[model samples]
Target: MKITPGTRSRATLATVAAAGAALLLLTSCASSTEPAPEAGGAVAEDCTPLHEFPTIQDGVLTVAAMNAAPKFHALSDSGPFTGIDATLIPEFAAENCLEVKFKPMTGAAAQLDLREGKSDMFGGLILKTPERAEVFAQSEGSILYETLGFTSAKDDAYATIDSLKGKRIGTLSGSYYVEPLKAAYGADSIEEYQSDSNAFEDLKAGRIDAVAWQSIQGFNFTDRDEDYVTEILGDEPAYPELTVLLENNWPHTKGNTEMTAAIDDYYERAKADGTVARVLTENKIGAQAADLYVNGR
Candidate 1:
């Protein structure tokens, strides 16, 4: 066949176009490995679902934080994250193939955050009450028993529930402390504060006689915040009637059964592997809280 100028020109054009296409394909392939994710990118089909739990944001577990408390959380919003939750939350997320994020909120707002789909889990000292069970999905008993305490500016600790009859007392509202305090000191007489700081102020100013608080929160009074006198109630042999055997549970949003079961399994595994004990000790919360997990309370 005789070569023509027209045919040769067409062949050259095809060669250049083919060469450019090959270069483009090479560039695309080189950039394809683990593409950079956008900010707040919750769902990524490429991600391996390690725990098989469906998150509000796929591959990301958003934690709704209750206000910073002694031993549970660090004080800052963007955290050094140096507490039991600080350690264990990341550990749970990391090992289970979830990217953990935290949203700082407190009290009723935190629970509402989880319910409203703004976050995935709520890790705090929440009691496993039947009423709460109806609204949220929760981990199995993560704590055995949490003792109650009465905090007063005076050195003396209230020994009996009867001691506070008709006296103005303050405590956190949603906590189990409310009903019990109301029972002893009539509903109208008791005042509830959203944060411990406000309650401490009331107790300090003499507006309230005492603040009924968690025995764990003794860390705040004797150490962290350091002013009040805390009298541990339930542990005393004389007032067994004041004793409350309450279990602290981690509450997730309801209907996330897969996440709930995955978290439950993570708790058992963490307890068995000494993660629970180690984390508790790191935050100086006493290593024995691990027994709560072991006892399955």
Candidate 2:
């Protein structure tokens, strides 16, 4: 083309502007598009719907219990394995929308059931023992406070622990009370029973002098039946503390994260809003009948 200063300048300026626009468009196109996400993989658009947690519509909660009377026991078909802790546990499970199932087992069997996943948790006011801490997870706070003491039938002769030194004492096999009975009398002093109700029956039948058992059950027994009367003795052998026991102990199971989180959330809300103490009081259970998660001493 012929070189003309004015016409060439205007034409070059327009051409240069058009070239710059083309480059900008190419850069924009290159920067805007990303590689397609992997097929059948996680993506912003194709993510599976998230189901709400603690929604136990189809989940089953297997609870194992030793049936320790008023604390937890199977009383006929109507009240089998229903006590302070037993009842409360169902409430919690229902709160999480779970189906409740109870399995009453002997002490040794209960331990086995816990480890083998036959039961998700155990019922009653169990003490958090170091040995048990290895196999089971204890509740962060106590659900019930049970006193260990002796109960006697009305007009029974035995009044003191010394009086029952040589007398037969009824207790559960592989229970915390067994050690105390053994310590007080001798290794073979106690008449061990797999069931607390059976032991209490034997006690009423005069097969045993005193039934060393949890105080709440003793109270329930004496209150419901006039024949059996329970009195609080000095103190129990191994100091009873009532708490829930899970199948997995301290570290807990990796799969049980949902269950554990639900329990923790329940207690956290309970502690914050006085529901913890209210639950205890409503059931007429626990010693102090106050917020258990808080420091009492």
Candidate 3:
């Protein structure tokens, strides 16, 4: 089932938006972008995507989302997908009175689909990098701000590699963190798990002292005030990833300027009016303070 903001409970949305706006800005995650945007001119309520502009299909946006995810997408399965893009995409479609067709694909497959014109866009929470721009056309909106970090049940001081020196550390198998963690600590101190759930379980059970994972995923599994995130800053030695200004952007088929422009336009209006943060909050994602996100591309 496709859900539009107009169809959803406005009261609930308002509450979420208020909560997001109330978040204390102790840290800065967003840089200046264009001022919100001017209001759109007269537009038809029953707009047809194909008739309005060129699309792979009329009235339907074929969006490819990763099949496996806990947030920014969902562990809630792909059908009627719910998450960041799940909300953002349909929100825009609703304004244009268009329908959305959700398709689940792996990251590699999503990129392939866009490259081959099999999909209009993919909401994969991919980091914006020059390398990716070489392939897919990136929409100007920001979905997430990602950072590589370490999380532990210890105090904020435990966020460092030296603090985890002798303690057993856990990380997802085949994750970029495995090598850098093992390098900084020791091979024997690192443990790799097949899935995030297992690694987090071990960390909570005290079987492992820490876990090296994405900051976004860490936020999902953890709420401990003492368990702080240590971002791998640029000044630090080269790490598996960098936390400095890594805004995640949605990718669309290359040369799809019309689609890209539509998404970007929607983003500016939403962000300027605080809709972006609220929608992300409604989907149980953070978009405030140091974790702020929007079109801060």
Cα RMSD (angstroms) for every candidate in the order listed: 21.5, 28.2, 11.1
TM-score of every candidate relative to the true structure: 0.74, 0.62, 0.62
lDDT (CA) per prediction: 0.58, 0.49, 0.54
Candidate 2 off by > 4 Å: 1-58, 73-81, 156-160, 235-297
TM for candidate 3 is 0.62
Using TM-score as the measure, what is the rank order of every candidate, best first? 1, 2, 3
Instruction: Write candidate 1's Cα lDDT for 162-189 as tens digits.
Output: 7777788888867767876676568988
Tens digits of per-residue lDDT for model 3 on 23-54? 11111111224221111222244444322435
Best-performing candidate as measured by TM-score: 1
Q: Give the CA lDDT, 0 to 100, for residue 134 in model 2.
A: 68
Residues forming the 10-long window of minimal summed lDDT in candidate 3? 21-30
- The per-residue C-alpha lDDT of model 2 at residue 47 equals 23
TM-score of 1: 0.74
After superposition, candidate 3 runs with Cα above 4 Å error: 1-45, 48-53, 67-70, 74-80, 153-158, 161-211, 224-241, 284-291, 294-297
